[model samples]
Target: MDANQQVPSEAALLGLLQQFTLETERYVEAISNRHHLHRTDLNALAAMVAAAREGKTMTPGALRAALNLSSPATTALVDRLDRAGHLERRRSEKDRRQVHLEMTDSARATGSELFSPLAGAIAPVIDALSPEELHIVMTFMQGVIEATMTARKDAALAEPMRPLPGT
Candidate 1:
């Protein structure tokens, strides 16, 4: 910031973060609707893709835990994606009993189709950032994510929701 500029207030910063989250959620919902995928399915695919980018294998159990889903629900999700040609189940060569999931070409194409426009829109802003600015932004994002995860864990341990009087 320049000498004449004031730092953003915490409320203003949080508001901006909220707006960014809302817009991102809207974008993801639009993609899910257009692709005829449930949000969970899209989330599952995203988890798998992130794992692949990290050079880690995604197994059914791992996915279930990542998504906090029941085994049967995860199995059903895998089957649905498999039938849609979006993913493949491969037996681990080192352990035939273990199964790993791989995103198929179709899934990659769909993901590109879904996100390319958003990436194009955001690329210029990201490109304009200096390395130092980029590092700060990355660190800020990581901090935000960690805080969000901590909040989620806290919420999970809070009192469970109960039905309203009428419902």
Candidate 2:
């Protein structure tokens, strides 16, 4: 870099990455508030809907792992969403004990209405990128996600440890 154009420091880049996630979370919070849902509940519903859109089945156990919640808490979460008419639970055909979660029609509509605007806004920004640029962005995001997970694990190792929220 020229004297007038300094390379970005790792700390500065990390801050930027963190701020992006943080701000996105604040946006999620706002959407959740509008829907009278907890942020975690909103996230759970969103994940279920997204998975369903991709023709994937989301088991309650898988959701527990995904959300890092305890079994009882996951059950409670499933119950809450079910009661709210945002989600439904179904027993596995092969294994009755295996519970699967899916978003209800109301959830599908509300989640889409709440989240589609942000998707629409970002579409152009993503569309501006070439295929190679998109790949690079995906690779970078995967690396960042892995690094964040590792950091969380390391932090947990350093602590006495508590259960995940809603657990």
TM-score of each: 0.89, 0.79
Put down candidate 1 lDDT per residue, 115-155, tens digits, no spaces.
99999999999999999999999999999999999999999
Overall lDDT per candidate, in order of appearance: 0.96, 0.86
Runs off by more than 4 Å, candidate 2: 1-6, 49-56, 161-167
How far residue 134's Cα lies from its native spot in candidate 2, in Å, is 2.2
Candidate 2 C-alpha error for residue 5, in Å: 5.2
Q: Tens digits of per-residue lDDT for model 2 on 1-167?
A: 67998689999888898898898998888888887898779879867866777898999887888788999998898889899998888888999988788778898898889889889989999999999999999999899889889989898689576788998
TM-score of model 2 relative to the true fold?
0.79
Worst 10 residues of 1 by lDDT: 4-13
Poorest lDDT segment (10 consecutive residues) of candidate 2? 43-52
The segments of candidate 1 whose C-alpha lies over 4 angstroms from its true place after superposition are 1-7, 161-167
- Residue 50, model 1: lDDT of 92
